[model samples]
Structure formats: C-alpha cells, structure tokens
Target chain A: MKYLRLVLRSFLRSKRRTVLTILSITVSVALIAILQSILATLNAFANNPDASNRIVVRHKVSITNLLPTRYADWLRQQPEVESVMGLQWFQGVYIDRSNFFPNFASEAEFVNTVFKEEIVEYSDAQFREFLRDRNGALVGKNLADKYGWKLGDVVSLKSELFPITVRLTIRCIFRSKRPADELALHFNYKLLEEGVSYMKGRVGTFFVRVHRADDVPKLIERIDRHFHDAVEPTYSETENAFQLEFLKMMGNYSAIIQMITGAVLVAILIVTANTMAMAIRERTTEISVLRAIGFRTSQILAMLMGEGILLSVLGGAGGLAIAWLLAGAVRGYVGTFLPYLQNFHIDAGTMSLCFHATLAVGTLSTFIPAYRAARRPIVDGLRSL
Target chain B: MSGEPIIRLRGLAKSYYRESLEIPVLQGIDLEIPAGGYYALMGPSGSGKTTLLNLIAGIDRPTGGELEVCGHTLNGLDDDELAAWRSTYVGFIFQNYNLVPVLTAFENVELPLLLTPMSRRARREKVEEALAHVGLTEWMEHYPRQLSGGQEQRVAVARAIVGDPELLVADEPTGALDHKNAEEIMALMEGLNRDLGKTIVMVTHDPKAAHHARHQIHLEKGVLDRTIEVNR
Candidate 1:
C-alpha cells in the first residue's frame, strides 16, 4: 500500500502514452466483450432451458425439404407425445424487401399446446377467433409492435417461394420469454395450402411437445423408427439440437467468432506489452535509484507489474461500461438480420471472461519487462546517469 | 577518530566484462576510515574513486577480494541481503542528487524507512526531523524539479540520513551545483559530520569541494597515490 503512490506517479509520468495505451486496451476489450456477448446470445438461443420438453421432427434430407403432414398425426398418436403441430416456413416480404422477419404457416389448433413455453401471454378469445377465421393471424408482440399492428389489422405478405400473396388479419398478439421468439408471425396452414396447391399436404417440420422431458429421447427414437421405411424418412431431435443444427447451417460461426476474439486479444497483448516495456525502460534510472536506496528486486518488480495491471483493469472497466451502454443499439441493429441476436447482451459469464482476460493480458504482458528491469544490476542502472 | 575502523578493505578488486574481455576498474587496495571521520576521495575521471565508493556503499560487489563495511562482510551477502544491510547501515548521495522526481522531499526522505517495520506516523516524524535537520522543513512538500540544485541535494541528504545509518557516502554530491550552492551543500555535509558524528566518504574531482573534508585520499589509475590531512 505504501508503494501505491510511487507506482501511480510513475504510471502518470507520461500522461499521453498512458492514456493512449488505456484507450487501445479499452477499444480492444470492448470489441471482445461485444463479440463474446454475441456468441453467448447465440449459445443461449441454441440451449434454451424451456426447450427440454419439446422435440422437432424434420425430413431426413435437409431443412428446406418438406415432410408429409400426416407425420404430425402419427407423432400425436404416440403415447409419449402430448401435442403436435405442423409448421411450414413462409419466406415472405412485407411492403419493402428489407423488412424481413420469420413468418410461418402453422397448425392453429395445437399452437398453444406445442409452444406452451413460447406463448407467454395471449387473449383466449382472440386465439379462438384466429382458429375460426381462415385469414386470421397470430402475431408475436414484438412483431406487432414493430409494424404498429393491432387486432383486426390486415397485413399482406408476398411470398416468393410459394407463388401466393396471403393477406392475414391480426387476431392475437402473444408475448414470449425470448425477444427473438417474439419477432415472428404465424397464420393457419390451411390458408397457405388452399392458396398454393403443392404445399397443401406438406410441412417443413413437426414440433412435438411431450408430457415429460425424460420421454423426449425415447419419443424421438420411436418416431424416427416408425417413418424409417416410409416414403419420406424422418429425423427427430430435441428442440435444442434442432436449433444447434440451424446454427451449424451458418457455417461454424462459434469457432470463427472465437478465433477473431483470440486474434484481438493477442493484438492487444502485444500493444500493451510494448507500452509497458517502453515505460519501464524510460524509468531505468529511477528504478536504479530505488534499488540503491534499498528496495529489493522483488519489490521493484511487484510495483512495476502493479502499474501494468492497474492500467489494464482501468481500460477493461471502461470498455465494459461502453459495451453495456451500447448493447441495446447493437441488439436492435444486428437483430434485424439475425433474430437470435435480439437477446444479445453481455451476460455474467461473458463479463467474467473479459475480466479474466484483461487480468491475464496485464500479468502476461508485464512479466518479462518488469522482471528484466527489476533484475538489472544496480551499478548498470546507475551508470545510465 | 580512533578505535576500530567503520570501513575495512583488504585487497578489494572490481572488474567489468564485455563479451569475455575483462576491464579492471579497481585493483588490489587496502584502506580504512575510523568512525565519525570525514574523508574525500579525489582522482582523475578513470581513477576508480567512484567505483571504490560504490563498493564500500554495498551498491556494487568486489569481484575478487574481501570487502567489509559497518561490521558486515559485504562479500558474503547476496543481493537482497546486501540491500537489507544497506538500508540499515549505509546511506548514499549520488553525483546527480538522485531524488525521485515524482516524489516530494518528504516522500523521498521517507523512502528508506519504508523498508523497515516503522509505522507511517513514525516514518513521517522521522522524515520531518530529517528535513528539518537539513533546514528544508519548509520545502518538504516540494518536488525535486521545483527545487534548486542545492535544495535537491539537501533533500537527497535528508533521505540519506533519515534512516540514521552509521555511514554516508556521496559521489560528487555538488558536481552539478554552482559555487554558492556547492558551498552550502559542503557546509551541510560538514555539519552532519561535526555535529551528528556521521562517517562521511565522498568522491569529488573539485579541489574546492575536497578541501572541506578532514582528509583527502588521492587515487591514480585504480591505486592509492597519497593521503593528505587538511589543516582546517
């Protein structure tokens, strides 16, 4: 504690250099925090705890391939399954092609059962109305709020994949735990099938809800085996695994992000190490004077390293504050393209990782230079005078 | 200035090496200065007077021969042990008055005491007393850059004596000072020796500064040339 003033004074000796170094670390660490938060958001999307009791059954070929609608009936008849719904992705655009969001043609009657975890709130009467009207649509709260949509508001979507323009009347607006899940709209599959002749008896996937989470594995095996020799083979997995498969289709995003983060960390380490080395080198005479005045080498080394760590921690703290302040804007901007990042914010785990990373960089970058400076012979140091 | 000498040297030798080539700076020398004696070492630039002062102060090791000062065998102590010994027994005032520029006079003087188990209050008190002794109590809050060359040297002197070490070694303490400041610093050193009974060993090329010492030991080419007792 007595040496703190000495370390601080030495650190502040070169104000411009110190501030520049700290800014470098701050910018780099902020970049790292944002990147790690994005990765964490994606991971949370792929590993949602609420998805444990749900399973997804898709065609054996690819996600784009459609499965027979009878597969949902077969899944519902299974003793382990509690509810099943056929879901078909409606790749559509609104007024502008840039205004894109996930729209799905879904079985309306079983939505409340199959996605019980997702539909946090909705009016029972509005849901019944959606079930009755062929053009009625169930919009997520975020999707509705985004487009200023309300009950009885008619919204039209032009689908390029299926030669049809379906005009849907918003009957219900539902909320969900995850923001990404609340950025979607679902209309009755009957409306889509009646408009497009080829999509009438086919679904992109079947989402099944089981009574018990433990029954999911067995139910998935049973469903796949039942359709193994059928005209279209089925691939069944837990909802979490399905989400992970979708993430995989994005081409090893996690590894790419991690590599980029690692590269940034290394670059910051080099810059910080150079700054510390130069600072210590500049104070060669001062260090020798301290040694001559009876300070031990270890004491000198500790003081130097303390200065480096203090610099890094200050930058790290600044970076975190900046990242936190900008998180909302990042979520809104990036989430437009990638819905999974709508829930993007720095989590506790990411904060901890960044904090530890700064500490490691501080310690590692300062060690060699501080040790060399401290271990230098006092006579040699004095000779510089 | 009788009884056993506070500093004793027998065949003290020091050498520097540059890639296997040896450069002998100080060759076989025998010397002693009794307790409370004020002496000066005077020689040419390469006469190795500063080297001898460094060795006696325990800042540098004698590569080949036995060296002892203030009852501790310096040759037997490691770097850390020597540092501990120096904190307790020896004080140094460099040619440049190497007070830490970032620290105030009080903090600079309080540095050596930080190595001890002294409380902050005690350290502050001792620093205040030391600065007062150098007649710079009013300037204790000032930094080295803010002080004149003589005042900086005085702060260096205060830092040297704050720990109450038995010996004080100065390497051209007033080399950078003008005539007036040099005289003032020499007077301060004289008072420290005469009134406080400190053993002072200083290295100086300035004949006027060397005249202030009780005895001057002249060295020529790493060997003692003569010892002259000054008739003050």
Candidate 2:
C-alpha cells in the first residue's frame, strides 16, 4: 500500500502520454462493452423466461409459408394446448421506411387473454370498442408516443408487400411490461381476412399456450406428427426456439461478433504494451538508482505492473460509464431498424465481464516490458544514460 | 571501536568483456580501512576509482579476488543477498544527488528505512533526526526540484545516513556543486565522520575535496600508485 503513491507518481511522470493511453483504452473498452451487451440482449430474447409455457406452430416449409387458420382448432383439441391465437405479420410502412415498427394482425379476443404478460394496462371498454368498430386498432404506448398518437386518432399504413392500404382508428393504447414489447401495433385479423383474398383462410403462424411447461417437447412432436400428411404441413416448437430461429436467420454471426471483439482487444493490447514499453525504457536510469537504493528486482517489477494496471482499469471504468450512458440512445436508434433492441442496456453480468477484461488486458500488456526492465543488470541500467 | 578494518579487499580485480575483447578496470588491488576511518580515493578518468568504491560498497562484485566489507564475504553473495547487505551495512551518495524527483525530502530520506521492519512512526522519527543532522529539517516537505543543488545533495546525505549504516560510500558527492557548496558539503561530511563515527570512503578527482579526508590513495591504470597522509 505504501508503494502505491510511488507507482502512481511514476505513472504520471508523463502526464500527456498516460492520459492518451487511458483514452485509447477507454474507447476500446466502450466498444467491447456495447458489443457484449448486444449479444446478451439477443440471448435474453432467445431464452425469454416468460415464454416457457408458450409454443409457436408455423408451416414446416418456411416461416414465409402460411398455415391453415383451422389448425388452431386442432391444436386447441390437444390436451396440452390451453389457448391458441393466429398471428399474421403485416409488412407495411407508415410515412417512411425509417419510421419502422412491428405491425401484426391477430385475433382481437386473444389479445387480452393469451398475451396478458405484454399488456400492462388497458380498460375493458377500450378493448370492447376495438371489437365494436371493424377498422379499430390497438397501439403500444411506445409506438403511440413516437407518432404522437392518442385514442381516436386515425393511423394509416401503405402495404409494401400487398396491393392495399390500411386505415384504422386507434381505440386502445397499452403499456407493456418490457420496453421491447411496447414498440408494436396489433389490429384485428378479420380486417385482413375480409379485405385480402389470399389471406382468407390462412395465417402466418399459430401461437399456442400449453397447459404445462414440461409437456412442451412432447406436445411439439405430437402436433408436428398430427399434420405430417396434411396439404400444408405444420412445424411446432417452443416460443423461445421460434424467436431463436428468427435470430438465426441472420446466420451464426455470434461467432463473427466474438471474433471482431477479440480482434479489437488484441489491437488495444498492442497499443497499451507499446506505451508501457516506451515509458519503462525512458526510466532505465531511475530504475537503476532505485535498485542501488536497496529496491529488489521484485519490488521494481511490482511497481511497474501496478502502474500499468492502474492506467488500464481507469480507462476501462470510464469506458463502461460511457457505454451505460449511451445504451438508451443506441437502443432508440436501433429500435428504428430492429424492434427487439428497444430495451438495450448494459446489465450487471456484462459489467462484470468488462471489469475482468480490463484487468486481464492490464496484466497482459505490462508483464513483458515490466519484467524485462526489472531484470536488466543494475550496472547496465545505470550506464544507459 | 575495534581497530580492525571495516572494509578489506585482497588482490581484487574487475574486468569487462565485449564479445572477445577483455578490458580490465581494476587488478591486484589490496586495501583496508579501519573502523571510523576517513579515506578518499583520487585518480584520473578510467583509473577505476569509482569501480573500486563500488566493489567496497557491495554494489559491484570483484572479478577474480576475495572482497569483504562489514564482515560479509561479497564474492559468493547473490544479487539479492548483496542488496540486503547494502541495506543493512552501506549507504551511497551519488554525484547527481539521486533523490527521486517526485518524492519530497522527507520521503526520499525515508526510502532506505523502508527496507527494515521499522514502523511508520519510527521511520518518520529517523528521517526527521537525519534531516536535522543535515540542517534540512525545516525543508523536509520540499521536493528536490524546489531545493538548491547544495540542499538537494544534503537531502541525499540525509537519506544515506538515515538508516545509520556502518559505511558511507560517496562517488564524487560534490562534483556537480559550485565551489562554495562543495566546501560546505565537505565540511558537513567531515562533521559526520568526526562526530558520528561513520567510516567514510569517497572517490574524487578534485584535490580540494580529497584534502578533507584523513588519508588519500591514488590509482593509475587500474593499479595503486601511492598513498598520502593528510595533516590538518
């Protein structure tokens, strides 16, 4: 502890160099922290704790392939299935492509039952009004606020994939338990069925709530087997697995992101090592003087290592703070493109990972240079200057 | 005090090797200084005066012969052991004063004592006493940069004696000082030797500085040339 001041003073011997080195580390650590946070958020989506009792049934051919709407009746007949809702994705643009949000058409009755977890608050009269009007719609609080929408406001969207435009009056605005769940709009599926001839008897997917979580695997196999010979075969899996399949559509980019993170850390290590090497080389004579004054080699090495670790940790901590602050802004930006990132944040787990990474970088960068400097003969070091 | 020599060198030798070239710096040197003796080593450049002083201080090892100081055989001691020996028995003063620039006078003077098992309060007391002896007690909080060259050297002197080591080895302690500061440092060193009973071994090229010692030994080309007794 007494040597801490000496180590710090020596580190600040070149104030500009130290500050610059710390900034470099801060930038890299921030980048790394953000990347790791994104991966964690994606993983959380894939393994959502709330989705354990739910399963999704889609066409076996592909997600783009549609399944018969009557399949929900067959799923509900199974003892394992408790409730079922038919969901069809409607790819429509509001004013521009940049103002994107998830818009889906699902059964209006199931909105207040099967998806009770998502709706934090909504009055019974507002939902009855939605059912009473054929062109009525329900919007999430986040989506409504983004467009300054309120009850009775008419929301219109032009379909890019279809030859029709949707105009509906907003009758319900609901808050969600999760931030990401609040960036969506759901309208009655009957509107799409009555308007479009192609979607009259089909739905994009079927969301089923199972009676028990432990029976999910067996129920998935049973449902898939029952429709094996059907004209439009069905595929069944847990809701978490279905979300993971969507995530997997981007391919196995997790490995690529990890590789990029590794490359960034290596670059940071080199920069830090070079800075530390130069700092130690310039102090050769001073180190020799310390040796002459009864400082042993271990003491000298410890001092240098201490200084290096301090610099790296400071930079890392600063970077983490920056990452934490930028999380919400980045999520808002990404929410425009990927709706699931609306809840982006640096969780406690990622913070711990980054803290450990900072210490590791510190140790790796300084060990070789500090050891070399400490091991040099005292006479040679004294004569260096 | 015992009449036996505190420092003894028997046929001491040191050499440097650059690839295949061998350069001898000191050869066939035999020397002894009794307890509380004040001696100055005088020679030309490359005459091995500093090299011999380093050998006696246990900072450097003899190449071919036995060397002993403060009753410890230095030839077989490893680097760590030598460092421990120096901490216990020897104190060093360099021409550059060599106080750490970042540390204040009190901290610099307290450095050698850090090697011991002394408590912080004990170390502080020792540092204050040493600084008082050097008449720099009031300047304890000043850094080396804030002090004059003479004051810096005095702080260095305080650092050297703070641990109360048995021998003081100074390599041209006043070489970088002005004439007035040099005389003042010599007077202070003379008082340390005469009053505190410290065995002093100094290496210098200035005759004025060498005259302050009780005896002067001259070397030429890595060999002893002559010894003179000073009367003052």
Candidate 3:
C-alpha cells in the first residue's frame, strides 16, 4: 500500500507509451468481447426456452426444398405428437428491405396450440377473428410497434422468392415470453398456398408439438422412418437441433469466433509485453537503486506485475463498456440476416469470461519481463544509464 | 571515538570478465574499521575505490576472500539473506544522490524503513527525525527535482539513516555538488559519525571531502597503497 504512489508514477513515466499500450489493449479486448457476444447471441437461438418440447420436420434434401403438406397429418398420427403445423418461410419485404422481420405461413388451427407457451398477450376473440378470414394475419407485438401497425390494419408484403404479393388484415398482436420470439409474423398457410403456384399444397417445414420432451427424439425417428420409403422422404429433429443444423451451414463460425478472440488476446499480450519490457528497460537504474536500498527481488517483481495488471484491467473495462454500448448498433447491422438476434446484450457469462481473459493476458504479458528485470544483478542494473 | 571493528576484510578480490577474459578490479585487499569510525577511500579512476565500498556494503560479492561486516561473514549467504542483512545494518548514498525522483523527501526517507516491521506512524516519526537531523525538515514534502543538489544529497543522507542502520556507505558523497554544498555534506557526514555513532565508509576523488574523515585509505591499480590516520 505504501508503494502504490511509486508504482503509479512509474507506470505513467512515459505517458504516450502507456496511453498507446492501453489503447491497443482496449481495441483488442473490445473485439474479443464483441465477437464473444455474437457467439452468445447465436447460441441463444438454439437454447430458447420455448423450444423445449417442440420438433421440426423438413425435406430430407434441404430446408429450401418443400415437404408435402400431408406429412403434417402423418406426424400427427404419432402417439407422442400432440399438435402439428405446416410452416413455410415467406421471405418478403414490406416498404423496404431495411424494415425486415420474420414472416411465416403457418397452419392457422395448430399455430395457437403449438406456441401456447410463447404467446403472452393475445385474446381468444382476436384469434377467432384471425381464423374467420382466410386473409388474416397475426403480428408479434414488437413487430407491430416497430411498424406502427394496429389491429385491423392491412399489411401488404411483396415476396422476394416468389412472384406474389401477400395482403392480409392484422387480426391479432401477440406478446411473447422472449423478445426474439416476439419479432415474428404468422399468417394462414392456405392463403399463401392459394396465391403462389410453387408453394401450393406444400410447406418448408412442420413444427410438431410433442406430448413429452423425452419423446422428441423417438418421434423424430419414427416420423422420418414412416416417410423414408415415400416419394419425398423426411428429416426430423428437435427444434433446437434443427436450428443448430442451420447454424452449421454457416460453417463452424463459433470456432472461428473463438480463434479470432484468441488471436486478438495474443496480440494484446504481445503489445503489453513489449510496453512493459521497454518500461522496465528504461527504469533499470531505478530498479537497481531500489535493490540497493534493500528491497527484495520478489517485492520489485510484485510491483511491476501490479502495474501491468492495473493497466490491463483499466483497458479491459473500457473495452467492455464500449462493447456494451455498441451491441444495439451491431444488432441493427446483422439483425436482418439473423432475426433471432433481437434484444442482443452482453450477458453475465460472457462478461465473466472476458474478465478472466483480461487478467490472464495481463499476467502472461508481464511475467517473463518482470522476472528477468527483477533478477538482474544489481551492479549490472546500476551500470545501465 | 571507536570500539571493536565493524568491518573486517581479509585478502578480498573482485574481477570483471569481457567474454571470458578476466579483468581484475580489486585484489589482495585487507582492511578493518572500528565501530563509529569515519573513514574515506580515495583513488584515481579505475582504482576500484567504489568497488571496495560496494563489497563492504554487500551490494557486490568478492571474487575470492573473507569479508565480515557487523559480525556476519559475507561468504555463502544467498542474495536474499544478503539483502536482509544490508537492510538491517548498511545504508547507502550515491554520487548522484539517487533518491527516487517521484518520491517526496519524506517518502524517500521512509522507503528503507518499509522493509522493516515498523508501523506507519512509527515510520513517519523516524523519517521526520532523520530529515530534521539533516536540516531537511522543511523540505520533507519536496521531490528531488524540487530541491537543490545539496538539498537532494541531504535528503539522500536522511533516507540512508532513517532505518538507523549501524553502518553508512557512501560513494562520492559530494561528487556532484558545488564547493559550498560539498562542504555542507561533509559536515553532515561528520555529525552522523560523531553524534549518532554511525561507522562511515565513503569513496571520493576529492581531497577536501576526504579531509572530513578520521582515517583515509588509498587504492591504486586494485591494490591498497597506504592507510593514513588524519589528525583532524
């Protein structure tokens, strides 16, 4: 405690050098934090709490390929299947591509049953109104508020993949337990089927609500086996596994994020090590004088290590603050491509990981240099100008 | 003003090497100084006067010889033990008044005491007394750069004695000061020796500074030339 002022003054001896070193560490740590947050957000999609008891069945070839609508009936025949819905992805733009949100064509009757846990604020009358009209749709509350669309408002969407326009009356606005779940719009599948020739009597996937979470894997295998000999075979898995499969198509980005984070931290280690080495080099005489004054080598090493840690922690905290502030902007940047990234924020787990990573960087960077400096013979150090 | 010998060196030797080629600095040195004795080591450049003082201060190890200071043999003690011994018994002053530039006079004086188990209040009291002893009581809060060369040296002296070590070793104590300040520093060292009973060993090239000591030892070509008892 008595030597704290000396440590701080020695740290700031070369202000420009210290500031630049801190800036380098800050940039690296911020990059690491932001990259880790992205991985966390991506992982969240597969771990959504609402997806526990659900499974998805798609065409064996690819999700882009359509499955026959009759597969929904076949899946419903399974003893463990409680409710089944045909869901089709409708890649559409309303007004502009920048205002994008998820739009899905779902079996209207089974949509409510399959997503019971997700819907937090929707009325039975509104759901009935949506069922009464073939051209009715339900928008999540977040999407409704984003576009300023109230109940009874007509929403017109131009399909990008198909040569059709979907216009429907908003019969219900639903809130969900998860913010990501509330950014979707679901409409009657038959309305889309009737309008587009390629989408008729077909769905891109089937969301099967299972009676027991433990039965999901067995039912998935049964449904796939039942359609194995059919004209269009089926691929089935739990909803989370299916989401993870889609993530796999992006080719192991989690590993890439890990690599990038590692590289950034290594760079930080090098920069900090170089800075401390130079600082210790400059203070060789002072260090020798301290030794001459009877300070132990361990004490000197502790002081230098303390200074390094202080610098790294300061930089890391600054980086974390910057990363936290930039999360919203990042969501805006990549949210359209990965719509499930809504409500993106740095979680406690990621922050904890970053905190430890910063400490490790600080320690590893200063260890060798500080050790060598502290162990140098006092006479030699005193000889250095 | 002397008692039993505080420093005893027998055939001490020190050598430097340049890529395996040995260059001797001090050789065949034998000396002893009683407790509370004020002595000066005088020599020209490369005579190893500073080297002998460093050996006596336990900052440097002798290449081959017996050295005993304050009743502890300087042989076979590890670096850490040597450091602790120095902390308890030896104080140092450098030619440049090597006070940490960032520290105030009081803090610099308080540094050596930090190695001891002294409380903060106790350290403060000791530091104040040491600075006052050197007439630097008013400059305790000033940094080295804020003081004159002589004042800076005085602060260094105060820092040396703050731990109340039994032996004070100085290398060119007034080498960087003007004549007036050098005279003041010499007088301060004299007071420390006579009033505080500190045994002093100083190295200097200046005869005037050497005159303040009770005894003088000269070294030439790493060999002792003579020991003179000054009649001051």
Global lDDT of each model?
0.91, 0.89, 0.89
Candidate 1, position A134, lDDT: 94
Count of backbone collisions within predicted model 3 = 0
Q: List the residue pairs that clash in candidate 3.
A: none
Candidate 3 on A1-385: residue-level lDDT in tens?
8778778988887889989988888888778888898899889888876788999989899888888898777778788988999998887789888778889888998888898887778999999999988989988987888778999999998888778888989998888887777888989989888998878888899999988898987887888898899888999888989889878888999999999998898889889989888888878888888898889999999999998998888889888988898888777666655776776788888888888988888888888989998999888887775
Report residue A57 deviation for candidate 2 (angstroms): 2.0
Q: Which candidate achieves the best lDDT against the true structure?
A: 1
Off by over 4 Å in 2: B20-22
* lDDT tens per residue, model 3, B125-198: 99999999999999899989899999999999998999989999998989899999999999999999999999
lDDT of 3 at A51: 89
Candidate with top DockQ is 1
Report the alpha-carbon TM-score of model 2 versus the true structure.
0.94
Q: Candidate 3's error at A27, in angstroms?
A: 2.0
Q: Which ten-residue region of model 2 chain A has the weakest summed lDDT? A: A111-120
Span of ten consecutive residues with least summed lDDT in model 1 chain A: A70-79
DockQ of all predictions against the true structure, Cα-based: 0.78, 0.60, 0.70
C-alpha DockQ for predicted model 3: 0.70
